[model samples]
Every structure is written in structure tokens, then in C-alpha cells.
Target: MRYFLTLYILAIVTLIGVAGFRGDISRKPPIEVFPDMDRQMKLRPQEPNAVFGNERSSQPYVEGTIFRGMPYQDTPINTGRISGTTNWVETNPIELTVERMKRGQQRYNIHCLPCHGASGDGKGITSKYGMVAVANFHDARLVSMTDGEIFNTITHGKNLMGSYGANINIEDRWAVIGYVRALQRSRLATLDEVPEAMKAALEKE
Candidate 1:
């Protein structure tokens, strides 16, 4: 019985030593086992590189390269697709009479008034947000501008304003220009020179 007891104690001690060496023992003080644990903690920001995949390669304008393997289509103003010197349409083909002026007014009110103001005074709701200042359509410099010049400005956009070619069709843009001319005329017209019909119409209202 004594011999058997001695052998059992020896086996238990050997097993415990093996477990401690292999880190299998639990509930031991961590400080005593790993004194350098404080030096092992670290944090790092992730790199900006995207993962490699078919989807990443398919995106357009990725890393400044156009994807989809298609040629870039240049917009009108961006690449001067339309000649700058050439007239957009015939000049002085027909006078901008009252009827054309009325149509132009309607188109301008629908599209331009929100940013250019009903009076072309550069005051619009969007202007309050610090966006590019809209030019006063009634400025003397603008008043002297040719109809074709005005059309080009509207189509190609000047300065901070983007081109309206995509939004307003060519014909409508021309009509708006005619309307702007009429507005300028009205602002500068002498009271005595007002058309009799227009004078009467104003009094009736």
C-alpha cells in the first residue's frame, strides 16, 4: 500500500510540471508568467488601400483612371467641341419682337429666376448660400452684349456658373436671351417712349 501511494504521488507531480511548462495551467498569476505583456499592446491606423477584386477594377475614375475600358466623351465647354469663333446660329435673321420677348420671359422665369432673380438683379434663394454670384443681367456691359454672345454665355457658362447646355435646349436658350434684351430695354426706356398699347395696358391693371 505504501509503495503504491508513493508511485501515485510521483505521477501527479510529473503531470503538473508538464502542464505548467506547456501553459495549460489556469488561475496562475499572469504577472509571474509573462512580465513583458505591457510592452506587447499596440494600435495602428489601417492603410487606405482597397482590397483587390474584379469590382474594384470596374469602378470609373478610380485612382484617376477611367474604368469600363471606354474612351472619354468630352463635353462641349470642357473640350471646346463647338467652335468658339463660329456663330451659334444666324445673327440678325429676325428682330426680337414683343411675342418672342414674352416667350423668353416665361422661360427665364422658370429656370433663371430662382438664381438670377425675377429682375435679373443677382438675388436668388440659392445666392444666399454663398454659391457663385449670379451676374446682373441688367448691367450696362451685359446690355451691350450681342444676342449670340449671350447665347454662348448661357450655353457654355461663364466663371463659376456651370453650362446650361444640358438643361436648356439651344432654342430655349436663344429665347431667354431675347427676353433678357427686352428686360434691359424696359429698364432703360423713357416713360414718354413707352408703346401706347403697353401704357394703356399698364393703366388698366
Candidate 2:
């Protein structure tokens, strides 16, 4: 009974010792019951290390390592051009579908409509803010460019334009290309190119 009472007193005193200490400043390291790999021995990036000759802790990526989620199988789809050649892909690799066009329209409006306008006429809202030299899709030079060239331009950027690659993904880029084509065709359409049903509606108007 005496030993148990003494143990209880000791426990109470220990608890008091732990709980009584509270302050804004702490000089001791934090108590971690579970370290959880927090203090790894591995050297941090750019840390001086003798293992590498230059003492850099970082190393180059493994040879032939393709980055995650980066596509390399379809050259034309991934890069918008054939391998080892400057020839641009004449047509979009993805099939034209209503859903795809809708998505393309959505992407274009978000990323491109600010500069290219709704009709791709180079008179977008940015023009009102003193931006000049926006390219018109209806222009003969742009119309003559193949799908691949346009995709490359979008990926790498052209004069006075920045690359949209970081802003859009691979598939979305193709969709935007398709939508741009539609915009161009609409602006340059002739009576013969219009479908007969549409032509009837147009003639009525």
C-alpha cells in the first residue's frame, strides 16, 4: 500500500513537472514520439557532397526516362509534325466530332478569345486595350499554314506571341486547332462550298 501510494505521488509530481512548463520561447528540440523518417541521411539537392565531382547533391535524370504523362508514341499527335522533317501535318490527327469541337471552343474561348477574337478576326478585346499585331485567321498566310505548323506555332510561339503549350494539354491543342480551322473556313466559305440545305436557308434570307 505504501509503495503504491508513493508511485501515485511520483506520477502526479512528474505530470505537474511536465504540465507546469509552458512558455513562448523553447530552446530544446521538439519531442517526437514517432520520428517518421523526418531525419533522413540523404543529402538535399545542391548540397555539397563528395560523391559527385562538382559536389552537387542533384543528379541528371536517368537516360531514356520519359517524363510522367508526357506522350512520345505518336509524333504527329504529340509534336504536331512528322519525325525528321519540316512538313506540317496537313490535317488534324484527331477526328472531328461535335463533342471535340465543343471542348475546343471552350478551350479557345478561355485561352485564345482574349487575343484572337470570337471570329478569329484579330480584333479581340485585347485590341481595345492597345494590343496590336494580333493575327487574323482569315488571312491567306495563316489559312495556307498546315495544321502541324499551327500546332508547332502554338507550342513554340511565334513573333509577338507566347507558347500556349503550358496553358493547354496535347489533346486540347488539337481541339483548338480544329476549332480554328472551322473559324477560318467560315470566314472564307464560298457559295459552292456551302451545303445545299444551308444554301437554301441562305438564299431565303
Candidate 3:
């Protein structure tokens, strides 16, 4: 009975020490067994922060920082391949349209035309410089590659070609790809595929 009474008293003391007397105002902060990061130092935008010399929480963008809704997401749209797999996506993720095609054409002219040529026939000005290694898009090997494979090539660069990933943003890279597809289609499109008006005019020739 004596031991039980002593243990009961100790328990009561422990409970009070841990939780404090009910309704009693305590000067000390409450003990948190599991803090769960309830309180933490954080930098708020536009707030005064001593960490930076300017005393501004806001900071300039770091070089090469690409803005993304989900910075770590692994999707075909971002990676040019199916998420969690090594296989390349079979087609461009961006919707094909005249505007997108025009954007692609513009970017391609700026970047790819130097080597791949205006016609994408591997006859760009670099040919005159004795640079014979540039790839011709119409070749059977290149034509057979999937869109994702081509995107990977554009992003990382294939043999002899340097990576354009740094120069081209993700969406623009896909745009350039869409333009390349149009170029490829230009070579293989059947007369039946031509617009009726254009077909009639061609037939007149």
C-alpha cells in the first residue's frame, strides 16, 4: 500500500510537470514531445531578412533556373520520355498547330538551320565548311527514330551533335521537333494528301 501510494503521487507529479496544473498560467513554453517542425525559420518574400545583406527576403533568380509548376515531376512533357521508364515518348506532347509550327520553324531557323540546313536536307552552310557530319533528317535511320528519341537527341545531342537543352526551353524544344516532323512529312506526303486547290494547280503543270 505504501509503495502504491508513493507511485500514485509520482505519477500525479509527473503528469503535472509534463502538462502543467490545469488552468494555471505558466511562464515556460509548453513541452512538445513531437515538434513536427511546428516552429521553424523561414524566408518570406518581400520581408526583412538579416540573412541577406540587402535585408530583403526576396532574391534574384539563380542563373539557369527554369520555372516549373512541379520542379521534380518526370513526365514526357518535361523529359521527352514516359515517366519512370527509359522508353522515349512516341509523339510530341505539345499539340500540333500552325502557330506551334511557325514557332518551331523560327527556333529551328535560328539554331538548327546552321547545320541541318533550311530544307533539313543536311545541306546547310556548314557543308561548305567541310563539316560533313551533320545529320540529314530524310535518312532512313533518322526517319525511323521515334519523336521521343528525336527529342532526346535534341535535348542531349546525338553523336557529333552538341546538346541544345541549354539553348532551348522544354516547350520550344518540342516546337522545334514539330517543325522537324513537318519537314519529314514534306518529303513523304502523297499527292492525295495535298489540298484540293493546290492539287488542281499542280495538275495544271
Q: For this target, which candidate reaches the highest TM-score against the unseen true structure?
A: 3
TM-score of each: 0.49, 0.64, 0.65
Off by over 4 Å in 1: 1-99, 195-205
lDDT on C-alpha atoms for all candidate structures: 0.68, 0.88, 0.89
| lDDT of each residue in 100-194, candidate 2, tens digit only | 99999999999999999999999899999998999999999999899999998888899988999998998899999999999998877788888
Clashing pairs in 3: none
As a TM-score, model 1 comes out at: 0.49
Look at candidate 3 and tell me the lDDT of residue 152: 88
Superior by lDDT: candidate 1 or candidate 2: 2
State residue 88's C-alpha deviation in candidate 2, in Å.
Answer: 1.2
Best by lDDT: 3
Worst 10 residues of 1 by lDDT: 74-83
Worst 10 residues of 2 by lDDT: 18-27
- Candidate 3 stretches with Cα past 4 Å from truth are 1-72
| lDDT of candidate 1 over 58-105, digit per residue (tens) | 333447666664733543332223344453332422456777668778
